[model samples]
Every structure is written in C-alpha cells, then in structure tokens.
Target chain A: MKQIVFQHHPGNVSSIVRGILNRLVIISFLFGSLASISFAQAENEVLSIKSPWIREAPPGIPTLAAYMEITNITESPISIIGVSSSIAKMTELHEVKLENEVMKMRKMADITLNSGQTLELKAGGSHVMLMGVQESFKQGAEIEIIFELKDLPAVKVMVPVKKDS
Target chain B: MNSILLKTLTIILGLIALGFGFWLAINQQRNTGPLISEEVGIVYPQAREIGDFQLVDFDGQPIDQQRFKDKWWLVYFGFTFCPDACPMALNDMKKIKVLFDEKIAQQVDFAFISVDPARDTPDRLKQYVQYFDPDFLAATGEMSDLQELATRVGVVFVVPENPENQNYVVDHSTFMLLWNPQVNLQAIFKAPHKPEDVVKGVKKIIAAF
Candidate 1:
C-alpha cells in the first residue's frame, strides 16, 4: 500500500499546482483591465460642471431655465452645439442681451469655451432654455441635462431644481 | 465755396453739441437727490404722463390707468415666454419689495405688462406674475394698445408679424418704469437693476412727492 501511494502523489500534486497557477493568471489579467479602465475615466474627466441648478417654473409654463458654471480643464478649446434633457421636448441656447436698453432673446447655435476657461450660465444672461417642459419641476427635484459637444462625448449633468432667492 | 460752407456747418454743429452738453449737465444737477444717489438710473426733470390704454387684467377684469390709481407702480413689459430678462427683472422687483418696510410696501405695487398679447392670455399672465409674488399684477391687451402705452412710457416692443409663429421672441424694453400714485411716469430704472438702487430710487421719489 505504501508503494502504491508514493507512485500517484507526484501526478496529483502537479495537477493541483497547475490549477492554482491558471487562476492567478486570470485574476491578474482582470485586475489589469480594471486599472486601465479607471485610468481612461480619469483622462476623460476634463469637463467639469459646478453648482448645476434648474430654475423651477410654474405649472403650464412653456419654458424653464438652467444655470451652471462649466469649466474646461483641457488644453484644447471645445464647442458646445446644444443641450438636451428628457424633461423638455426641446432645448435651446438662449441669450438675453440688453442692447441699447432693449432686452432681446436670441437663439445661439453653439457656444465656444476656450481652453482653461469657464462659462457662467446665469439668469438674465446666456442660459439653457428648456422648451415645452413636459412636467413641473418643483423645488428640490433633481433633473438631468445632457450637453452635446461638437465632437466629444456628451456631458451629463444632474441639476437640482431651485426657486430663485 | 464748398470748403467755406463745410467749415461753417462744422462750427454750427460744434456749437449745437456744446449747447446740448450744457443742457444735459444742468438737467443732471436738477435731478440729483438722495433718491437718485447713484448714476445707475434716470430721473426725469418732470414726471411724464402716459396715454390711456385699455387692457384686461389677469383676472379678466378690464384694467386701464384707472385700475392702477393712487399707488406707486414699478411696471415692466415682458411676456410669459420670456425665459431670462422677465424673470430676472421680476426677481429684482421682488427683492426690492422685500427690502421695503410695510408702510412703503403698502404704497407700492408691481406690474408686469405683456407685449406679446397674442400668446399671453389672462390665465397665462396670472400664472406667470403670481409665480413671483401673489400680489403681483399682470395684464395683456391688443398690440395697438400695447404699442401706444409703451411709447407713452418711453419704451417699445416688437413681436413677430406672423401670429402663427409661436416660437418668435418679442423684443421689448428692459427698462422698468416708475409710476407715481397718479399713474404718471416718474423715473426710469435701467437694466441690470440692483435692488438697493431701486429701493433708494423709489424711496426718494415717494419722499419727494
């Protein structure tokens, strides 16, 4: 009996060692892929939005507005074609300019933000105009606005609805 | 001969400009007061009279100059579709209202008159103005009436020619007119209205009156 056990021990031990080595290789590969994915995400975080907020409007109102401070940390300039949100039927870049004592609302096709610059979307100035709002945006409700860049990935910003103070 | 005529014309134009500058300086001095502390707004030498306009209030009641009788009014012309300037100006007016004491608040009222009457119905105006403050008043009327009232108050607005173009914007004055209790135009508060300036202006005008 001792002679038989010694003869099979070498084969059994080698098989078990091979199985453990295979699992180690697979785990390292998985960790490598995850690290690269996180690195890519860190690289893509060049556009940052701060203090995003939506101005709550009354029920049955046709249009509402959103304001934010958008900063571009990249070395290249970016052009924002437009904005879209699920809460509105349509979205537009609207500018309220006081030209010669006349307040005029004009549709802006695109907004260009230079590299390392910030654009302030504020009330009584350039703002994101959501038209044909489908639902009422009460105070403290959260909404999502998607900004379409000219050639880059869309930036999604979650904004909270707030009443003007 | 042409050169001599040109020189004479230039001298006459220069004299006219100088005279105009002199008149403006004197007018500025006359209008200055504690109420008109900063040069951010315009205080007319004399309060101007506005022409009569027939309109319907947010409650569907007929409103004219008579409806706004015996109370100071800070009137702004904007439509409900206005996404920026109207809301901002109204917010400023709201802040100004909050800054005033009860006595002054009682003597003052806020009005938002819509130039885009084609879309700003009584119901819409009611929702729009009352959104800012329940006490806020709003009205809309025929384009002719709006135009006449705007001109009398030294403001103007132009809407789209086609009534079907619902997406069109109405280009209107950003100035807020200060009306005396008698319903006459008292002063003009320019755009980018600061609440402190507006409050000071209103107090001064009321105290002077």
Candidate 2:
C-alpha cells in the first residue's frame, strides 16, 4: 500500500509540471505575434520618394532648383516640416506662381500631404531652391536631400543631377 | 627690249582687267544681296538714346554711356540664376551670331546685364557669360546704377518686398534690347524668341538703314 500511494503522489507533481510547460508555450506564441505586428507597423514602408532631380545650368551659374515627387502610401496623411541639402549653401521650399502674366517664385514654410496623395515638385510650380552651388553637379552624380518630418525619423533621398527635358 | 615693253603693257592690261572684275562683283551685290523685307520688327518711331548710366562689366571695369558707341549692341537684362529663359535666350543669340558674315558679326556686341546684383557677382558673370558665347559680356552692379541702365534698355525688374530673404527670385523682363551705333534703343525681341526670327529681323532692320 505504501508503494502505490507514492506513485499516486508522483502523478500529481507530473501533472503540475506539464500544465506549467503548456502555459509557457502559449505565452511565447502570443508575445511573438504581438512583437511582429508592432515591428511591421513601425517600418512604415508605405512612404516613398521618387524621381528626384536638380535642374541643370551653365557651369558658373550659382543657383539651381531641385524637383521631386513624394508619395504617401499609408492610409494616414504625412506632414513635412522642412527640407535640407549639404550640396548647396542653403535650401528652401519654393513655389512658382503666375502673377500678373509673369512667373513669380515664393518660399513655403511647410507642406501637408493627404492620404494616398503624391506631391509633385516641378518646374513652373513647386521646387527646392539650392542656393550658391559650390561644386558643379555633374549629370550623372547623386546628391542627398533630407526631409524632416513631424513625427517620423528624417529620411534621406538621393537625387540625380540632370538636365531638364 | 621690244619683248620687255610688250610684257609690261600686257601686265598693265591684266591689272586693269582684274580691277574691273572686282568693281563688277561689288555692283552685282547691291542688286542681288538685298530684297524688300515684308515683315520687320517693331521699330520705334524715334530711336531713344540710352542715357548716361554707370555699371560694371564682366571684368568689373566701369562702363559709361560712350563705351557702347560705334557698334550695334544687343543687350539682354537677366540673372545668371535663371534656368530656362535666360540660357535659351543667350544660346539663341549665339546661334544668330553664327549666321552673320564676319564683317556683320564684328559690328554687333552682345551683353548680359543682371538686375539681381545682390546675388550675381562680377566673377560669376565673367564665367557665366562665356558658356553661351566666348565673345558675350556679362555685368551687374549697384541697384540704382543697374536701374539707370535697365530703364534706358526698357526692361523692368522688381525685387522682393522682404529684402532679408537672400533666396528671393527677381521679376524681370525677358526681351532683348536692340540698339544702334549711337546707343539708341531701336527694337525689342520678345521672348519665346527664335533664332531665325532674330536673324531675319536684324537683317531687315539693317537693310532699312
């Protein structure tokens, strides 16, 4: 009778250990999925920069403009606070408007992008002013243009220096 | 001795024949080289003289009214910072020069004067103007001085209301001013300018003169 009772007591301990192992596996699976869901959201692969280029001018010309298209793939809108480039002495957001039958340019502080909207910066319209170009931007060379956002980390875009078609 | 005298007479007769042939070529061109031009550029009823003004050349040399005398001047007022309009205009000016005869080409002077002197420097102008043509001249100087030249050239330029913004784009006219030997403004070629139109317009204007 003593041997039988010892086996019965061991059975209780084995059951408790098995229950703890099962709970741990369930906890691990839940945590893994939760981490992956947040990681995918944080990556924000929906936003993209496309076809960035600087307008070409004569070698000694000191100023030129850069153009690009920004696309917001996410369902929410993106807000742009500022832009910068190391290639130029300074950079400013500008827009060209027809005023009194003549084209005029003005500086813009910030821009807001709507959901699923692609903003185009082009000639005779919006552009990035690159002032005091020290180095000649060769036709095939690449330059980095950084966009400062309101919420996310700054993104650096590599734009090609090309002539206007 | 008789053979020597005959040779001298033959040489004199040959020289006279050559002179007569040259005279005939010159007379033929008067009738053949010129045709009555149907369409001419808008000519000012009175060619207004470009009054006394002070500005610097690409070399930073001071330019007075008298510096432009004794030549046909084609002056364009624009900034080097301009991407499309300015380069296209200057390039067309170069093409037009190529179409002219060497004598006619030598008589014309091409100049690019910047209204945006705050940003355009003489050193930059010196290098920038040559990109279009080696013979072209570029200049920029004090605002009042530039205005004196601009007004005489019939170009209008306006700066930004806020001068603190160093990156301001200037609003200026794009037409090229054509002037005569006396520094008088004669005609204006409006932009979206074509090289052929300029060449034809200049030829017609010269023929009228």
| Residue-wise C-alpha lDDT for candidate 1, range B1-209, written one tens digit per residue | 99999999999999999999999999897776345744557876688988577988998888889988899999999888777788889999999999998889999999999998778889989988888889999998888888888889989788989744455678998988899878889899988899998897788778887
How high is the CA lDDT of each candidate model? 0.84, 0.76
Best by TM-score: 1
True contacts kept of 2: 0.40
Q: How do the residues B28-130 of candidate 2 rate in per-residue lDDT, one tens digit apiece?
A: 9865653323232356657887777888888889887688888888888888887645766787788889877777788888989888887788888888889
Using all chains and alpha carbons, the TM-scores for the candidates as numbered come to: 0.84, 0.64
Candidate 1: pairs in clash: none
Off by over 4 Å in 1: A1-11, B1-34, B37-39, B163-165
The window of 10 residues in a row where model 2 chain B has the poorest summed lDDT is: B33-42
lDDT of 2 at A73: 75
* Worst window of 10 by summed lDDT in candidate 2 chain A: A1-10
Cα lDDT over the full model 2: 0.76
Give DockQ for candidates 1 onward, in order: 0.54, 0.23
Error of 1 at A83 (Å): 1.3
Task: Report how far residue A34 has shifted in candidate 1, in Å.
Answer: 1.5
